[model samples]
Each structure stands twice: as structure tokens, then as C-alpha cells.
Target: MDFPTMGDLADKWLEVHARVPNGFMKGRPFTQSDWQFWCTANFYRVRVGAEFVHPDDATDENPVLLNQAFVYRRAQVVAPQKTGKGPWTAAIVALEAVGPSVFAGWAEGGEVYRCSDFGCPCGWGEKSHRVPAFVYQDGEPMGMRHPSPLIQLTANSEEQVKNVYRPLSAMIRQGPLSELLLIREGFIRIVGESGDDEADRIDVVSSSARSRLGNPISFAVQDESGTYTTTNKMVEVAETQRRSAAGMGGRSLETTNAWNPVENSTAQRTFEAKSDDVFKFFRQPPAHLSYKNKRERRQIHEHVYKGSPWVDLNSIEAEAAELMQSDAAQAERFFGNRLVAGDGQWMDMPKWATKAAKRDLPFGAKVCLGFDGSDNDDFTGIRLETLDYYQFTPTYGAANRRTLWEPKAWGGRIPKDEVRAAVEEICAKYNVVRAYLDPQFWETEIDEWASKYGDKVFVKWPTNRITSMWASLERFQGDVYDKDARFRHDDDDQVKIHVANAVIRARGLDPATEKRRYFLGKLTDHQKFDYAMSSVLAHEAVCDAIAGGALEEEPDEYVYF
Candidate 1:
């Protein structure tokens, strides 16, 4: 269900109080760009003053009030560089600090909002620009200021924190907001009756650990989350702030450029999370456009920076080209707003994403199976590939036809019976000609399968063999990037995540012969790559089946009904 928003009030409030922080339009009344307004509107959207009741079964006998009426607990915006994230964040901070940001109740009609009503000196009757008024319409949502707003402006480092902090200071100093806000050396305090009230202030929080980090905050702005990672402990800081905000019925906003997938940064994790309470806005350029091509790169820039008219396409192109001279992937990620992989990434994610054409395989289709197993501390899964090479896990099928199984999801051990039954069911439904089973920890199961199904159908394909595994990986990569490739996979989220998590690991030169080989490894110990391995084994089985003539076409016979 959707709710009415206080975006109109917020917009008008900023028009009277906020100002452009810097550049040629410095000190001018701030106006939101189209994208900025959209984000703000969605973030502020909230429920009316109504008690919670189950939509399926509701009764006046029992109703519960919600702790917070916000539709989203947090919001993230992923955009290109120089897209006005800084000034926009500063404006939001100011709004949270003094403006009517919280949902109050529904208005019947003929009500007006005045700065004097909230203890400010501004008024609508004043001939000057300090006064602002908001006339409420019938049934419109009203807004109220937080009594004590404690905001945190955070980033990976002190220098990065200035991205928002500097703009905030400038806006407060250059506008009517200066009358109510007291700009300090490291923070800004919202002036109260006694003046310089410490309870209502916006503080700069950087990567350096602070003792008061867990203090309950009214709102928080996480800047440049793309660089917040475990190494600097910024990820932990972000989590801490959110937990504190939840305690105070507050929310957070994260702003960043597109991130490197391999870094496992905060922005990447937030973007990939399956939580329904988080709002995300990322405008990516069309997939068909190539960032490496100069002409196509310009098109990408134009698309990503569409709403922000301040960004000069020519300037962006020149900067991207210069950056591309050394770091093309970073350039694309920063300017193209694309999720590009860093060094040692085994697969190109954009190419893989482009190949997601999921379709149902007809019943009784000739297929091959691949299995990778683990007892615990990792994933166990199976992948299926048709004879003509359309790969997918049976998870998309009926509940009983499970193919991929995770150990962590099954009480820290693989569900042996369920897996065996699923395999048995698949074998009965499809004409499975070949199956490659990695027999590292499941040798007994593999042997039993070989006995139940013919030995040729189920073979122990050990993956530790560097020579063979490397060759199979090479073949899979070739097909994925090939222009006329026949390989395609199901639109499985697990497959995509596992594939993205894989990194290249060198085996160095062979001891007996000076031969070099490489294999896939996980980016981190906790990140699993089993599904990717299963995919590689499945493709290898398809190749071996074709080589052995197991897929030879049979003559068709027609029978009249």
C-alpha cells in the first residue's frame, strides 16, 4: 500500500530556508532537480495517523499503532560523480535539523504552517524573505519538526565527510537558515531558546572510531558508501548508526556512485540486499552501450546525468577519458553508473547480466547434470544443462524438483535425503545422458549414484585437477564472451552472486613441466563460489557429451492417432 508524502511542504520549506551552497549559483534559494525531488518525495512518503491492522483480517477490536509510519527505513541513491549528491544531502540535513520533517497527522483543511508556531521568528506577513508559509489542503498530510534532531554526517574518512559537511555549512551561512543554525568548527548546532542547544546538532562522523557512535540519532546521512568497506571499519560504523537510528524512530540516507562489485562495499551490500524496507534509486545506462567506445561512452554519460543539467557532458567525457587511460573499469563505474568488476574478477558481470534469457525446458528434454558438494561452511548445489546448452537449476520448477541446496540454510549440513530424492526425480522426468559429480566429500554418494544410474551417466569428476579444471574454465569464459555463443543460464540470483564472487587464482608454473595454470577462487573466505563451480562442471559435461556423440539425433517415427 502507498501513502501520502510531505514532499510538497519540504520543497516549499527549502525554497524559503535553503540556498545553493557554492559555485556560480551560490546564495540563491535552493531548488531541487527532478531526480532530487523524486528521491526526496519517496523517502518522505509515510502513512497517515491510522492504527495498523492486517489487510487480510482486520477488526476494530484489536488495532496496533506503528512505531514509524515511514514506508522505507532507509534509502540509497547510486549515481554518477558531480551529480549534486553533496548539496542535496546538505539540504536534507538542514530540513531534518529544523524544518517540519516528521509526519504529524491528516489535515481537514484551512490550516497553515508558520515558522513562529515552531518557535522560529520567521513569518508569512514579513516583507522580507525570512518568512515562509505552507497552506494545508483538505485531507493532506501534515509535517512537524523533530523536537531534538541529532544528525550524523559520515564517510570513510574525515576528508570525505567534508563533501556534505562543507555544503551544509555554506548553506546555513548563506541563507535565512543562518538565523536558526549555529555553524561550528566540526559540527552545526540548531539554536534553541537557551541558544547553541547541544541536543539538536549535526556532527561529522568519520572512519575513526568514536565513543558516542551508538548515541540515538534522529537522522543520518552516509556519504560515499561505495568506499565504505571492512578494511577501514566504515561498514561497521554504518551498521551502528542505523541501529541507533532505529532506536529513535529515525532513518538514514546513503549516497554514492556505482561501486566495484569485488570490493564488497557497503553500497554493494545495500544494493544487493533483499530487504523490502530499503528504497534504492540507481539509473544505469542501457546495457547495449559499451563504455570502452568513445561514442557509446558519451551516450552513457548523457543517460546517467540526464536530470542534472549542471553536469557538462563534454567535461564528464574528458574526465572519464583521462581516467580511462589508467583505470577504465573505475571510469565506467564512476561515470557510467555501471557495476564493473575490479582486478582478478573471473567474469564480466555486465556481459553475464545481458545473457539472462530464462525459459522453461520442455518436459523430457535431454539434459546433463553437475553436482558440487560440501558438508558445512560452504554451499552444495546442482546445475542442469540441455544437450544444446541451455543451463539452469531446477529450483525454478516445482518445490520437490530442487537442484541447488545450501548447507548454511539446512542446519549447517547438506540435506542428503532431499538432495538424493531431487536427483532421482530429475532423472525420472528428463532424459539425463551425462552427469559430472565432484567427488571430494561425497564419494560414497557419487558411487551409489553411479551404481543406481549407469556408470557412464554419473562420473566422479574431481575439480582439484588443475589442468582439466583450468581448461574447462577457459572454455566456459570463451563461450560466455563469444559473439555467437550458444551458452545461456537461468535468471538465478544465487548463480549471479556466486559467479560475481569468484576471483582468479594463479597456480604458478607446473613442477615437472613449465606450464602455467589458473583456477577460480573466492574473493573472501566467507563468500561462497560453489554455484559457479557447479555451472563450470555442467558446461564441461555438455562438452564431453557432445564429444562422445551421446547427443546424436535419432530418427523420428510418426504414429496416427
Candidate 2:
């Protein structure tokens, strides 16, 4: 007969079952045979394919008859899959008045009969693979896979087939099956006090494991005695014949939920290799060796020489000694021998200062002026100097000490109008080319001067007070020591020489407090003098610009009124 599609069959089954009284069996009184018949009839609606007819004399009195009836009926429903690659299925069957002994005996008896030459006419009478089995009574099957040697639950009775094997078979047929094999057993146990009469006796020790494999083989023993106990033991056995080929490095193997020995071993090996001290050298080398040796040495040299030596021992000391003994007479006589030295105090100036005063202030000559304003009865002063323009002036008394050029000053203090007037006069007189004016005293006054002078007057207002002062001083010192900068004046008596000497002397004085002390005896106020000193220190850029011949862009037009 042609079978209908699964959809059609399911629909018909649902309709027929819908008519059965729901929960009616709970209150109804029925014999076991009656219940069995009813269950069989309802199950028969589906085409189970197999014939399941009981013998004419089958009865509850004969255990064999009952077993036959149950097995036969189950066989019908335990139908083979139409596609044929699966295990059989069965229903749960309950038994009354059965014990562990009877359960074990039944299984043993069945096994004996099935394995015998004069086989009982059960389906197992023919040679067939022993499909796995599991039994459950109180609880539902845990849905574990087969050929799993570990059985989580079991019962000891002929009904064990219903409790165990039926569930096991159903589970096996459910696809996505594992290759692992499981052998298990089920049993029952009792507990409580001996004299209590009514102890908490219950089922226990329901499952056991027979064998396992993959990476490490394991076996389990489940005890159904008093407090149920399950113990699993693992043994590491090498896979000689089944060894994997070394593809890449490590072997890849299929796995189950259980621990795998091969993977653990491989992981351990990998960890050891990575953590070994021998590999550290390759990972990180010495920092010094990583850089180019010559480059590193060059960098060190540059840093050391960034600032020049503080004193030009060969020239400065010798010249200072020679000039120390001479007065204005010797100075003038020395100037007479030098072509560059001019008349006036320029002769008495230090050799360097004398040479500087003789130098020409051409339009493009590098020039810078530092102004000290008169504040609090202080005298305002302005100092000027040309950079890199030098002329030699001879000193007859100190013939061995040839003078170097130095800076000159054009400054003094009077009234605000006088300061302004003096600045204008200097700007006109000396072609006082470029002048820097202190902006603090009267910003408007300096602005007026700058307006009159145009690009010739540069108003310098200290913005970043401390940082600018420090940076300017550092640059000035650096340029001086490096011989990259020099004062442009004729002699030690020139305004430039006096200002430099005063500044140096002020710096050398020990302050009574942490703050620097400036004597107002030589100026109007200490603060203005300090500011003037800072401006002097800040002239390094002006000096460098002059020496480099770029002073026209912006001259150090610092002027004092």
C-alpha cells in the first residue's frame, strides 16, 4: 500500500488522538491489560510497518507470554527508518512487583536465549549487532549519546529494558550521532535506619560506564548501593596504528565532551617552547646595539659642545693682564699707534672697546640698543653696539695685547620729556639707526618715539617675563663663550664697556635674599635696573642678527630719555 506524506499522517493522527478523553485515565479503574490494549490501539493509527500479533494463549500468568506481547507490540512501533541507517525506537513500559534480582535474571535469561543455537523466536534469535540500551524508572532519560561507555542512570530488572534500552535506542537514532561507544547498566537500592521500619528508602546507583576512547580512554563504575556513587577512571594509551600524520605541526583530532590527552600534551609542549629563556635573546636585543654607533657618538659630541667654553684662556686673560697696569696715558699712546682708534675717551677704552668704537656704523651694520628707564629717581640709560664690525686699536704700553672691538652706549636719564628729547636727539645724531625702548614707563611715549622714528625705533616689552629673561640670558652667554658674539666699542671707557662692566659686576654681587638685589645708586630704581639688565641679556638675538647682517629687518631700537 502507498503511504501518505508525513504531513498527512501527522494530521490524521492528531485528529484521532484528539477524541481520546484527556486525564480520564487518572480516575479510571483499569487492569494493566486494558491499559496496554488501549495504548496499543492508539499507537496503531500510524503505519508502523511491522506486524505485532500476540499468541492466542498470552497471559499475565506466564512471564514469557507477557514479554512476548510487549516486545511484539513494541517491534511494530520500533520500525526501521525508510532510509535504513538508524536504530529502532520503543515506548516506556512499566512493571509491577519487580525486583533487582528478577530484573537481572530476565536480562540474563534473554541474553542466554538470544545467544543460544536453539534461539528463541524473538527478533534477536538471528545474529545482529547489539544496539546499546538504557533504563529509567523514576526519572526521564538524560539524552546522552551511544556508544558512550558511561551510563548516568540504570535499574536492575527485566523492566530495565523499558527503563534503559528503549531510551538508549531512541537516543541513538536521533541524528548528529557521535562515534564514541557507551556501555551502561541500571540498578536499584534502598536506604534508611534498620529499626525505623519506615526509612527513606529509594532507587539509587542507576548507571555505569563500560568503555571509552578518542584521545584518552576512560571507564566508569556506577554504584547503586546506599549513597549512589559514580567513579570514572582515565588511562592514557598511545594511538600507534591510528597516529596522525604531522600536518604542519600539531595533530588535529575529532573530540567529544571528555578531556583529550593528545591536545593537552601538544598544548603543554607549545607553552614550554614559548616560555623558554633561550627565546628571549631573539625577541629583544641590547638598546645601544640597535642604534648606529657613529650616529650616537655624534649626537653626544653635539650636546657637549652646544655651549662654548666660558673663557678664551689664550686671548682674554693675556689681554686683561696687559691692560691692568696701564692708565689713560698708556691707553692714549696705544691708540696713537692704531689706525682705527679715534680721539677722545675712545683711546682709554679697553683695546676691544677702542677697536669697536672705531668701527663704521654703515646703514646695514648690525646694531642693537638696550634702554634702562628712570623710575623712582633712577637714571634711564641706553646702550648701543654694532655686531661683527670690529677694528683693531693698538696699545703702546701693552704692546702684546692687541684690542678687540666692543659695544658702545648712548644713554642717561632726566625727565620724561628729557628722555623723549634725548632719544630723538640720538636718533638724529648718531644716525642712532635702530633703538629699543622700554615699553613699561610710558607705552604711549615709546609709541610716540617709534612713530617719529618709524622702522628705526623698536619698542620691546617683556611679555613672558621669567621665561624670556632666562632664555635671552642663556643665548647671550652661549654666544659670548662661543666667540660668536662680541661687544662693538673702542675702549674700556666707552659707554658700551662701562655698561657691560656694570652688568657683569651686578651679576657677581651676592644677593642678601633669594631675590636678586640691584643697587639703585647707579640707576633710578632697582626694578627698572633689573628690567634693563633683562633687556641687555635679551639682546642676544639682536647681536646675532647684526653679526649675520640681517639687522635692517628689525633693529634693537632700545632708547632711554
lDDT of each: 0.84, 0.28
Backbone clash count for every predicted candidate, in the order shown: 0, 56
**In model 2, where do residues sit more than 4 Å from their true spots?**
1-366, 387-413, 429-434, 455-457, 484-487, 492-538, 544-561
What does candidate 2's lDDT look like per residue over 285-362, in tens digits? 121221123343233222322222322333432342354355422221221111111212211222222233354354
Candidate 1 residue runs with Cα over 4 Å from true position: 1-3, 47-67, 106-116, 124-141, 192-197, 361-366, 396-433, 448-455, 506-517, 546-561
Per-residue C-alpha lDDT of model 1 across residues 252-327, encoded as one tens digit per residue: 9999999877778899889878798898999988777889899999999999998899999999999999999999
Candidate 1 to truth, TM: 0.84
Cα displacement (angstroms), candidate 2, residue 307, comes to 42
